[model samples]
Target: MDLDAFVSAHYGEWEHLRALSSRRTLSGAGADELLDLYQRAATHLSLLRSAAPDPAVLQYLSTVLAKARTASLRRRTLSWSRVADFVVRDLPAVLYRTRWWWIGTALVNVVVAVLLGTWVARNPSVQTSFISPAAAQQLVNHDFSNYYSQYGGADFATHVWTNNVWVAALCIAFGVLGFPIAYVLWNNVVNVGVQGGIMVAYGHGSEFFGLILPHGILELTAVFVAAGSGLRLFWSWVEPGARTRADAMAHEGRSMVVVVLGLIGVLLVSGAIEAFVTPSGLPTFARVGIGVLAELAFLAYVFVLGRRAVREGFTGDVVAEDRSATRPTAA
Candidate 1:
């Protein structure tokens, strides 16, 4: 049959398959039938392409193919809706499985911060070069100390919450731009380093802990998590793995989103503490203890509760049976 004739004859069946694919669960037989039909259609198209028919016939075939492709894509999008649920549900499981990666990234950030601190201690002038004179002067003049003292006020807490949320959102959003994630990570790492250096420079290394540790640990840890999520998102686009780039990206995007959400949660809590608790003239040990408890709680949620919730949501039963035995195995 001619390409146009073949397509016209099968068009209704194609539409039916397309519709079936949109449903949440397709029976094995239904999936098989759809695949069989697709293969037949593909064979016909291949034959038509090889024939190099008249321009009019080619044009008609092209239109039909385009329509079929569009219908197929629509169905795939619908199918992805089901897959997306699994993605969201299994996110904590995925992150737990990849804990080493997250830990490594955070350790790197901390190490870099320490190294920067050491470098600044050795060469005090480098601080002036890195930060503006006005900013450096402010740091030297205990402006941060004053700011933290007033930080726990209602207005200051609101401001900190708003600003930190913006930063967390930007880290996740810019990750979609591929290369920009690198810049985001670099900026965050350097900021941490500078903060560490400034604390040591002011001879308030211990006092700095009292002022910063209450919120800094959680806030900084969240930043690392944000950076890791960005990296995962970028890797999805650049997929160096076995899967195609598009497939890899779709898979990674799901897990990355969970990480981002978790980071946002951490940021919110950290911002509240930074604004309200840090400025309360709390003792160093009290701040450190609070910070440790908060950090431990976050870890528990991320690694334990989150993981269990995901597994419970997505896990399916496996049924096994011996064909020769007349009894079925309980799932």
Candidate 2:
């Protein structure tokens, strides 16, 4: 086979296929021409491989065939169906899957915060280290409570949402490294502890709980979820069990996308509560009740809807067709 002669004979059809594949829209006639070109290109590919076997020509023709095949096949488009499936299955399943990571994180951190708050309250030296006596008094007396209502509800909500989401985003983004997430958690709970301790020491414990619980319950829970998801990402590569480290990292990383998106919604709700309910004239019980309900609703979403999705073999991962190829397992 004369390679140059064969290429001269069939290059037009391959080029034509390439052109058609690159097109965004095609007419009926153009579509028919594309299919014809696709078939001819496939044949040309086979002939070149068997006879001429020129690497460059064979490679070009192979690429044309692949593009033509893909262009002719049905392309998946976004629709309500896909969005619904993602919300109902993908997001919740991911939340459910990483529940323990964040829950345990929350538990340990909360205990740490409580213990630290107690220590701070008892030790005048520790309290002064955080702030001078005058500043501490100011924070407990007026600054702490006034912070909630200073801005209008809408503005405050947006600010709080943006800030909380930023924190959550950092936790999710740095999940692989591990220690950065611990530092973020440390900064977060320490702030909570310092303020709570100051409020308690100043004889405003009830006021502290009243102002904080309304949004803190859900807001802090969302933060915990983000941190937990990050910790799990770290653990995925560390203790991949049967899977290789890269495979585990890839699988968990994809699922973290769902968790990241879901946390945005969670944080939004908590922000709203912080801005409106926390500062409203509503009774403390009513405000805190709302927060509790929101928290419970989220828990039910994970344990109920999330569990159902899991039972159906959902792993918070994209569909098998969409994700990377799974490694073959040995018996």
Candidate 3:
């Protein structure tokens, strides 16, 4: 079809043009072809805009421009480095912006941990009491001390990393269900509480800290982030602000997708540490130091670095200043 006829036919179908442009194949030849077509369309649009062509022709030109813009964006997005940059830059911003949810989840975890600690501190026997007698006997008979000694080996590292990744992904995925967040929190609380009770019962509270705290700070923080994302999803359904529930959920899901992916990175790093480093029978003070440092780094990232990056995103440049200026003032 001739350019004028093509424009006339497609002028109002900007969305269709955009979809077609974004489907350009990912290859050197494909990219070159798409870029060439985009440039041609853009040039045509500029000429049409200047000429003040008929409304239909102008509409068609607008579709061409829209398609070109879409193609350009798709090309940029498909770059490996662009993917990495998005992960590093935008992911943190998403987490930072929704940090109140993260904080609430973290506080919930801390309360659970503290309550377990208190319970153990009160009833020393409950730790052993809560577990099955057979389990307690098996644990007492097994050389758990030696098992702990070998905990940070390669196999353990692989297992921890895999398990943590699975858990993190599940937490995010299950957020689609309204009750999954609650289920995750309940399970985590029980596991942590039971573990704490076990440590105190076995007179291994201090030893447990040395084993867990180094990586627990990062590991648990990752869980909290996941929980926060899930909570945000739940809140969208229950308390949509100025939007239909479906619309709010969709919007929140877009934001949480990035946050959930970022939390996966955190889980991977934390899992590696938990598997290979934390179980090395390190000194309590050293473990605590590492934990504290990790906590500080997370706080700085979420509250400072991440927030600053988001603020920098707003450049105060008016994208449609002419259109705004020409529009009539509202009554």
Q: Highest TM-score among the candidates is held by which one?
A: 2
For candidate 2, the C-alpha RMSD (Å) to the true structure equals 8.3
Which of the predicted structures, 1 or 2, would earn the higher lDDT when compared with the native? 2
Q: Could you tell me how far off, in angstroms, the CA of residue 204 lies in candidate 1 after the best superposition?
A: 1.6
How accurate locally is residue 78 in candidate 3, as Cα lDDT from 0 to 100? 57
| 232: Cα error in model 3, Å | 0.4
Count backbone clashes in candidate 1.
Answer: 2
Tens-digit lDDT string for candidate 1 (1-331) = 4656766786686666556645556577876775666666566557767774556655654555554555444444436764554344444565565566557778887788789887875676887778775886677567767877654477776777677767666766776775676676678778767766776776757766677789888887776666666666776677536655665565566556666655656777887788777877667788778888888887775688557755675321111221122232233
Candidate 1: residue pairs that collide? 152-275, 152-276
Write one digit per residue (lDDT tens) for candidate 2, span 40-142: 7787788888888888887788788888888898466689999898889988899888888999999999999999999988888899999999999899889
RMSD of each: 11.7, 8.3, 11.3
TM-score of 1: 0.62
Model 2 residue pairs with clashes: none
Compared with the true structure, all predictions reach lDDT values of 0.65, 0.90, 0.68
Once superposed on the true structure, which residue ranges of model 3 sit more than 4 Å away at CA? Answer: 1-74, 132-134, 137-152, 313-331
What tens digits encode model 3's per-residue C-alpha lDDT throughout 1-331? 2656756654544444455576755577666766766666666667666665667767756766676676666534358875755655677677777789888888978998779766864674775567765675455445334554455466776777677767776777777785777787788877777766666566667766666787888888888887787777788889876666776676667666677567767776776676656755667787678777877887887777677767877111122331123322233
Q: Total clashing residue pairs per candidate? A: 2, 0, 1
If ranked by lDDT, best first, what sequence of candidates would result?
A: 2, 3, 1
lDDT of candidate 3 at residue 19, scale 0 to 100: 50
The Cα error of candidate 2 at residue 260, in Å, is: 0.3
In candidate 2, position 54 carries an lDDT of 82
